[model samples]
Target chain A: NAGVTQTPKFRILKIGQSMTLQCAQDMNHNYMYWYRQDPGMGLKLIYYSVGAGITDKGEVPNGYNVSRSTTEDFPLRLELAAPSQTSVYFCASSLSGGDTEAFFGQGTRLTVV
Target chain B: TQLLEQSPQFLSIQEGENLTVYCNSSSVFSSLQWYRQEPGEGPVLLVTVVTGGEVKKLKRLTFQFGDARKDSSLHITAAQPGDTGLYLCAGGRNNLFFGTGTRLTVIP
Candidate 1:
């Protein structure tokens, strides 16, 4: 299994620009999450989905959105990107939430100028 | 939101030395796990401890969960350069919460 996969290993966006960070998992996990990590920091949840058609905001979900239309896909959208959004984003999935092993993508390094 | 705090945020040691990293939280967790991450890469799971006061060992690394279920520790013996990386501890049954992480560097 490819496990979890994220598109565009790196990207740079201008202020007010919008883009989507694509994430997909082949493990058929029920839980998918989007997290951002600043330089020398821990992961902060942006959004998460428990299952298809169910998405919820996390600690830092102000400038982002997420959609889970299929069991294998969960994409994160960045609207009106700002410089503060510059960070490394990671997509992860697990069979279920809580105490389960999560498989993570290599990460998408995003820079908003 | 539950918070997990890790101590000794940074450490550097000579090869073959031993070290321990701690993770503490005011909130209790059903389970806790340890993960190691390298530069430009995502974290990889090292181990998981669920039972209070549980201890698990893998090769030169040992992991323990606090008896109160509010803390955890990771110990590495005979550390090597390969063990040099960012170690993170996460807990929570509803959502995964991560600690700030401990950066370890082993010099040969």
Candidate 2:
């Protein structure tokens, strides 16, 4: 089974352009997260969803939005693509919050020009 | 407030050398995890350490959780070129907080 899947493995955007990154999981996990990794930097949490219709911000939430309408899907939206936002974005899912292993998707490499 | 910090942000060594990476935090966690990520890919889970003072070994890699559950370390013995990558340590909170990450390059 495909544990977690993300679309548009790579993308290039211009300033002020917008796009959505799609993420889906087949494991039926109740928790999903969005994170961004800068060059030689650690992954920073952007947003998280505990379950359907529940979303919360993490450390870095600016310039991004997320919605979880179904348990299997969580999409992250970039409203205004900026060069600073250019990084590798990752989608992850976990059965629950604490002390649980997270399954991660390959990731989306986005570049803002 | 970044809760986790890793040392030796960049490390380069020759094959068969030994190296250690450290992760430190002021917050106590229930568990800690280690992950390795290749270029252009998401991080992959290497191992998880639970319980204070727990130690786990996988092949030539060894992971240790501090007795107070506030820190951890990863040691690689006789490292190979395949071990070159970004190593990240995560602490178990409501969700995992990844460390600054250690970039390791093993030269052959």
Candidate 3:
């Protein structure tokens, strides 16, 4: 089913630059999320969507934005990237919001200088 | 912002050795999950515990959820090189707050 697919496996951006990390899932999941992992830190959620056109902020939502125009796509936009934004970003999706399994993409390794 | 806190951030063990890592939190959750992430890859779900004091086993790995639903523990028996990775514990449903994680290295 291709599970979850992420684009631009790696990216490098300069300070004040902007970019978007693209994510898509063919599983028809109702819930999608964007998370960043720094070294020893497991993962911090940046944003999430319960369904199309519905988004919410998570534990660490600063410096990032997301949109869910469709259930298959949830893109994270980084505006004015900073060094602190350099990390491995992952996109995940699950069938529902509770108790079900969430599938993840390989992740996009981003570096901001 | 990280509600779950894991202990012994790092651990190295010889093949066939046994070890345990813990995840603790002050907030209660409806359910908790365990995930293992290999180097250079995203995490995959290992198991989930929905009921307090629930215990679930997957191969050589044993997972236990606290009676109060605020903590969890993961134990590995006769560890192997393939078991080396980062283990994370998460709580909540929609938000899914994750722990700092425990990185394990198993050497042959």
Candidate 4:
């Protein structure tokens, strides 16, 4: 069973280019999150959705946006990619929020040039 | 804001040796989880501790939660090369907050 899947395992984006990091889960979970990990740093939350059509900003939400149009999909969009945006992105989902185990995807490695 | 801090940002040890990693926080949590991530991979859950002063064992790894639910520790006995990875601790109340992480390299 595919717990969580992210598309475009690796990508290189030119400055000011826009791209969408696709994330989908088959676990029927209600809680989905987007996080980015920089070298030698912990994962920082970007955006999260508690359910369909309900999204919220996280600690580091600048230069990014997210949409949860369905229960199985939570996509992150970068309107204008910058050098500072290069990082490994992970998508995670949990059965519910708080005190529950989260399942993660393989991750997408994006490099903004 | 809630913060979780992990000690010994990096560690390298010989095989068969033991090591301990710590996670501390000023805010209390309802539960704490440990995860290990290898190169080019997302973090994978190792164990979770809920109750205060709880101790849970996963094979050669022992995880303990502090009595105040604001601290936790992970001890590995007889480390192996396969145990090399970045270990992270996450505390959860209404949301999950991750620690800085400890990078462990068990040299063979």
What are the fnat scores of the candidates, in the order listed?
0.68, 0.62, 0.60, 0.53
TM-score of 1: 0.98
- Point to the candidate with the largest lDDT: 1
Worst ten-residue run, lDDT, model 2 chain B?
B89-98
Predicted structure 1: lDDT: 0.93
* Residue A44 in candidate 4, Cα distance off native in Å: 0.9
lDDT (Cα, tens digit) per residue for candidate 1, span B1-108: 888999999999999999999999999898999999999999999999999999999999999999999999999999999999999998766567789999999999
What is the per-residue lDDT of model 3 for residues B50-108, given as tens digits with 9 covering 90 to 100? 99999999999999999998889999999999999999987767756678999999999
Per-residue lDDT over A1-113 for candidate 2, one digit per residue giving the tens place of the 0 to 100 score: 99999998999999999999999999999999999998889999999898999998888999999999999999999998999999999999989884688889999999999
Please provide, for model 4 over A1-113, each residue's C-alpha lDDT reduced to its tens digit, 9 standing for 90 to 100: 98999998999999999999999999999999999999977888888888999998887999999999999999999999999999999999988875788889999999999
Q: How displaced is residue A109 in candidate 4, in Å?
A: 0.6
Off by over 4 Å in 4: none
User: Tens digit of lDDT per residue, candidate 3, span A11-94?
Assistant: 999999999999999999999999999977789989989999999999989999999999999999999999999999999998
Better of 1 and 2 by lDDT: 1
DockQ of candidate model 3: 0.67
TM-score of each: 0.98, 0.96, 0.97, 0.97
The CA lDDT of each predicted structure is 0.93, 0.92, 0.91, 0.92
- Lowest lDDT sum, 10 consecutive residues, model 4 chain B, at B90-99
Candidate 1 residues lying further than 4 Å off, grouped into runs, are: none
Residue A59 in model 1: shift from native, Å? 1.8
